[model samples]
Target: MKIDELHQVFLNYPRVCTDTRKIKPGDLFFALKGDNFNGNEYADQALEKGAAYAIIDEEKHTGKQKILVENVLKTLQNLGTFHRRSSKAKVIGLTGSNGKTTTKELINSVLSKKYRTIATSGNLNNHIGVPLTLLSIKEDTEIAIVEMGANHQKEIEFLCSIAEPDFGYITNFGKAHLEGFGGVEGVIKGKSELYDFLIANEKGVFMNADDPIQKEKLKDYINKYGFSTSDTKYYQIRLVEANPFVVISVEDTIMGSQLIGEYNFTNCCAAVIMGKYFNVHLDKIKAGLEEYVPSNNRSQIIEKNGLKIVLDAYNANPTSMYAAIQNFTKIEGGTKVLFLGDMFELGESAHEEHQKIADLAKELDFDNVFLIGQNFYEVKSGFKKMKSFDDLKNHLTKYSLPNSTFLIKGSRGMALERILELI
Candidate 1:
């Protein structure tokens, strides 16, 4: 069947589910295949779970409720793109090496105050995820915050072709996904694709004036934002403090946020600036920023069992891990105990980068330091090394550090947050 026909069917159902286990009655199920599993095999299971239609690409699975397509993933992407083009909502496409998700959430929080909005769920900002997010955009949504993430060059450009955003923002470039993107230079070229999209399309840009790289890249662009009262800046915001939460002064107003760390300060500033650009009142913007709270183990502070815990285990790379360590050291309280987990996706640079992180940790004056993961095993540091979280827990079973402040962080796969159960 044609894409138009499939889109019509999607319009009728208006819900997309990839997992049969999560499928709801009347939802459209896409049999998407992944590295290890073939979703075509689960097409019937999706229908049995009450999905209105099971979109399949395998000819053998095609029949009755199972709608056959040439390619299941490609079909879903097309459906998402088709839905995006048909929407009247103004789209904001954003990408970066770091802070993309937080910035997306901040923008969504601020914009949702004045406009009906939907953002990319969690970290679903990839090839399949972007389309899923775009397809989720409702007819009444005034703004769509489509976040695009990439490890290699041109990936953002491809996502842009699908999202076709009216505006763009690139949260600062950082060292991440080095395995997929060739090197640091590759990281820059890859993330700058968002700027390329906006510049090529003549769409508005939300530039950060405080960032010299952003200033240079967006120097030719007119639309911009930052923390200074510059002639070229569209909005100005100043960071007051970022201890346990972000506190900012925006023009005549002061906003205190529930988010933590200095990295998040930029994220909040971007939101306030974008809110003002979209004509949202400063008061509403402040309220929205204040209402927003950090979750999913990204910059969350929990005090329990007389110990202060900083959980930032959602993800980690060289740049973000460095920033997290910098901020964790500054917080004044009980004895600081840091559990630094290995940064992933460094590829060939894993050893060197992990050594750098170990070196940085030694330079810092923390009370106790414990390093986990195989990447850190060979790194020379004064910090104690644990092969895994279980190893750390085994040590803790013999000895406990109560009433001490702890910074627990690692890549998502590390599950370092489980350390909370011990503390």
Candidate 2:
């Protein structure tokens, strides 16, 4: 479809949904095709459900509002680009091996206090998700915080081309998605595409200056910020109080946070630095950071039936796992128990990476450790280990109780959060 045609459709009807499940009355539904499902088959069903109109490729099916398109997914992308030109919102694109989602959430939470903000929901940071998210932006949105994620080379570049971010933030570089990205260097090349995009566009980049790789690649950019030796603007974690709240002071000028640990402090820094760059006031930025809460299971402290639980089991890579373990170690003196599951998709380096995690467990001297999943056998060998989640139950039931802290974490594949039931 032509750009003019898309803009006309967008101006006439502001919202779009590709999934029939989420379609609301009066919303336009784009019947997009997928590997295992043919959305065109469900076009009538979507219209019947509540969709004001259905865009389908089939010629036989026709209605008053139904429009025919050669391809629905491509049309959605084209329509999103047309909508992008109408809004004056500064787009900040964030992508990294770890912490991109959390950073996006934090940045959105912070920016919302000062502007009419639109953010990517959940892990909708891919090809179809990006366009769908952009199309959701209302006409009055002042800032759009888009999280760009990928498992292979140039996936980020493709998304960047669509969003054309005015600014960029890379949380950190680490070993993740080894199957598609090949290895750590491949991850660097893939993620740095955003940095390259920002440089090419003469925009700005925010990164962790402490990372040598980030510092090197972003040095030439005129507009850049980081937390490292080279960074004039840096965030430092001064103290960790633990429990009721974590005290974290950033960059000397800003006071400490209620959120726990230095890692979270750094995450807050990324949001504050980027939000401030967008002309958001310091007080507004502080309010936004303070209002932010943990999404999914990324480090939320909860109490159920009088039992304290630290739920860190959303998704885990080596970098995030290591950070969680370090945070566990600093909890004053408690009967610290760690319920760990397998880390997935590490490719050829799985053994070494698993063993390295085991070494961290031993170094931290966790009071007790339970390893779940077959891949965690190597992790079991590194510490006082249990064979599986059931074995962990047997041990815990037979053992005595203590007022100690417990840390549960693993990749999504292992579903380690299930362990909380037995705790």
Candidate 3:
């Protein structure tokens, strides 16, 4: 189909789905192909499930708007680019090995207080997700926070071509998706695609001055909202302690939030910088960060059965595990218990990454450590071996966990959160 014709459908109504499972009324479903299943096979099912149109490559599908395309995925990408160019919104693309989602949410939270904002929702920050996010933009969207994630060298470059961010932020480079990215250097190369793109496009870059590696990569971009690098174009953050909230000092103004940890403080700093550059008032920026709470299991504080649970177990990599450990150490607690689980998708570096986390746990001086998953086996063998996951569950049942703060962390594959249900 011609670009103009696709625009007539896409511009009028968004290209919304590929799966019939989640199709909503009036949504345009694209019959995309995958290894196991052909979306064309489900075209009729999508229409029956409330999709207004089913876009397919197969000629057999019949419906009101079941138009055929040579390739659905590429077609969606093209349509997304068209929609992105049609909008008046400024886009800020964010990508990194770790903390991309959290940072995207933080930036969106701060930016939304002053402008009509739309951000990448959930884990929708990949090739398919990026296009979906772009097409979701509406006329009122003054700003779009696009989160891009990649595990291969050229993935970020491909994503950037479609995203074409006006400004950008690379949260941090860490050990993640090592299978596809190769190693730390490959990780850097994959992530730096964003920086390279920003430089090529001549866009402003916001970076974490605290991270030496990230700072070095974007050395040419004028730094914004960081401390210690005051001469390097930065924003200062001084944490104020009080009851259940933290006071953040930006310049002369002190802003407060219920969030804890130096990592969150840094996350807030990035948001403040993004907001300031857009001319958002300091007070509004404060409200935005303060009102915004961390989502899912990342840095969430929960109270269950008289025990304070720090459930940072939504997903884990070496970088996030370290952050959670550091954050846990800073809090005043009864007895600190570490329920560390496996960090998955490290590929060849799995052993080394797992051991590094074990070393970190020992350095933190935890009262006890509950290691889970096969990856933790080597760590347990080297460090003080804990009883298995089965034994730990039994221990929790027989004995009351002391008023100690419990830290549950691991990659998504480990399902470490299951301990909560058993407890």
Clashes of 1: 0
Instruction: Please write out the lDDT profile of model 2 over residues 1-423, one tens digit for every residue.
Output: 466775677677777888888888878888888889988888888888878778877787766678888877778877777787778887889899877877888899888887898999898999888887787788789889889999999999999998889888888888788768899889999999999999998887887777888878976666776654344566443443444344544445444454555567667778777766677777777677777888587787766544566778888888888888887776554577787888888888887887888888887777787777666775546454665777777777777546756788899877777766765
Per-residue alpha-carbon lDDT of model 3 for 258-308, expressed as tens digits? 566666666677788898888999888888888888767877788887788
The TM-score of predicted model 1 comes to: 0.97
- For candidate 1, the per-residue lDDT at 346 reads 93
Residue 96 of candidate 1: its Cα lDDT? 86
- Model 2: C-alpha RMSD to truth? 2.6
Which pairs in model 1 have colliding backbones?
A: none
Instruction: Give the per-residue lDDT of model 1 (tens digit) for 139-166.
Output: 8988999889898889998999888889
Q: Estimate each model's TM-score.
A: 0.97, 0.91, 0.92
Residue 421 in candidate 3, Cα distance off native in Å: 1.0
User: What clash count goes with each model?
Assistant: 0, 2, 2
Extract clashing residue pairs from model 3: 225-235, 226-235
lDDT of 2 at 19: 83
Candidate 1 accuracy as lDDT: 0.87
